[model samples]
Target: MARNKREEILDVALEMFAAHGYRGTSLDTIAHRVGLTRQGVLHYFPRKENLLTAILQCREEVNREHLQAGHAHEDLPGQMAAIVAHDHQLSGLTRVYGVLLGESITHGHPAQEYFRKHYATVRERMSASFAERWGDRLPSGLTPQAAATALLALLDGMQQQWLLDHTQTDQPEIIRDVLTVLLGSPPVK
Candidate 1:
């Protein structure tokens, strides 16, 4: 079907972009990888920037689904743990995003708007979640926005470290430890 082919092209292009930086990936490479001619690929994505935008949009949808699934759990810590566990269980998509997001900091990167909007939306949703969970018990000076930003930063930093040294490090444990310190609770056993 037409939709299936479009999805296939998108998947292949995402893998290519993740493996090689955006500047290094080409429509020709993506077409060859997807077993399509350049013109065929162009039928689905007229421009490389369009393909990049599609990839980022798909990633945001997938991440929002995953986070929402975790949020269905009973408590904030449980939700956080589920999210962290899901990260460890999945392929390196999160790591790939981390790399791309870092690269997007350069001037005129194609994904700048995508990454900026992604971070803003994620921060707002997370802050709302934290406020819903701990509004009554939060320390007098604490703010939900600050807590959300800290949690996101911690997760990003921990995942980067895990990607660098998965053999010697346990990412979920480190995240649990950090959260325990922040929440003044015992670490997950």
Candidate 2:
């Protein structure tokens, strides 16, 4: 589908933000990339933080859809493997998240609260789903919540490695190996 102006701006901004950290990319550059004026960009997003929020939300929606694609199975590690495979094709988006996540580590960064809330929501949803099928704790003795935290951390760490050297790091294989250890030797079918 052809993108509307706002969508076009967002697409360009996502790419730009992915290429450059949030602080490195400017609205003027984003506007120039999309053939818009500063005011035109502002018409959709009054602040850069707003644009960041919109971009994060869009990414979350897409990730949620990917995670849910295999929800019928009780195999969370499998679902996560699928998410890893999916993320490989969206490295730009992954870099955008990694950069912003690092910057958001500082207290009161604009994306700080959003990242905090996003993580809590993700952990809650993942744990809830896993708990329903696998019980509150995995065989590894980690609770579903703890497992979720570990899984997210693994993804972030692997993304950093992949972003640094994509040719050498196999993100999905690494994730799968870790998940096998955490979930079980055979990965629950």
Candidate 3:
């Protein structure tokens, strides 16, 4: 029950942090939503930053799980497309990701190191996937590393656009169209 409560608090924190940037969210707001006092919240998080760290850690763990499921080893393009589809449903987490990522690009942000290491790991794995799928080079004359970087940039750009106007943007279609260039066809579900 105690562990469940902590998870619950984290969920609320994730939602609040997504709706309002980290600096805009307070321990009071999270505690209030969770029906706990600020002191009670502190008993679990100790500090608001600690809670933020936990939220980010959770996100990394979930992403790691998805990667470890052999998705990258199998049909990478299909897996990547599936990831985009999955994100469509988790708009809140995506918003939190984009907002925090933009904020962390500046110097001295609390999440700077975390984001740095996280992207390095993501890029490494993605580059490997591209290499395994496309051999030494893609049609554009870019190496796997360059292509992986471009793909990441494309995904982020599309996500930001979709987040701004979901009704106007076809996130999954755009993602699939991009994958078509890599795989010769859009990845099937």
Candidate 4:
């Protein structure tokens, strides 16, 4: 029961945060949405900063799960497709993270550490994947870490574009094409 209540609170909080942003969202708004008193909400999250931390932890878990699942498959294209599909499924949270990450540039934001660690982990994982897939054929002057950083940057930029115009083009196809060129492989059609 306690776990369920916590999840309910987090869910309501995510919705409120996504809609109103961190500063714009209030504890009262979250409590009202979850049908809980302010004190009840406090029982789960003592402060609004605690709730923001929980939300970032939840997003990290979600990203780790998706990345692990994608990595389990040996086919790189299939893995990329899975990632794109997962992003489509969780676009709302993705947008929320993007907004918070941008805001976190300000000193002492609750999510600054979370975003920093998240980006570091993402870069490391992506670098390892790039090395595994293209280590042999990489140009003499190129390093896997550099390639990984570029790939992650590309994906972040592409996601921002897709979020702005979901129907302007097909994101997965665009990603597949760009990756194919980078990896010297044909499109995954």
Clashes of each: 0, 0, 0, 0
TM-score of 2: 0.85
Candidate 4's TM-score: 0.82
TM-scores for candidates 1 onward, in order: 0.81, 0.85, 0.82, 0.82
lDDT of 2: 0.79
Tell me model 1's lDDT, rounded to 2 decimals. 0.73
**Ordering by lDDT:** 2, 3, 4, 1
Which candidate's lDDT is highest? 2
> How close is each model in CA RMSD to the real structure?
2.9, 2.5, 3.0, 2.8
Q: Stretches of candidate 3 above 4 Å error? A: 63-74, 132-135, 182-189
Cα lDDT for residue 4, candidate 4: 98
> Residue 29 deviation, candidate 3, in Å?
2.2
Query: Candidate 1 residues 78-112, lDDT tens each?
Result: 55666766766654565557667777888899889
Error of 1 at 40 (Å): 1.2
Candidate 2 C-alpha lDDT tens digits along 53-144:
99888878888887777653646566667777777788777778888889888757789999899889888987886688679677777788
Which candidate model has the greater TM-score, 1 or 4?
4
Cα-based lDDT for every prediction: 0.73, 0.79, 0.77, 0.75
C-alpha RMSD between model 2 and the true structure: 2.5
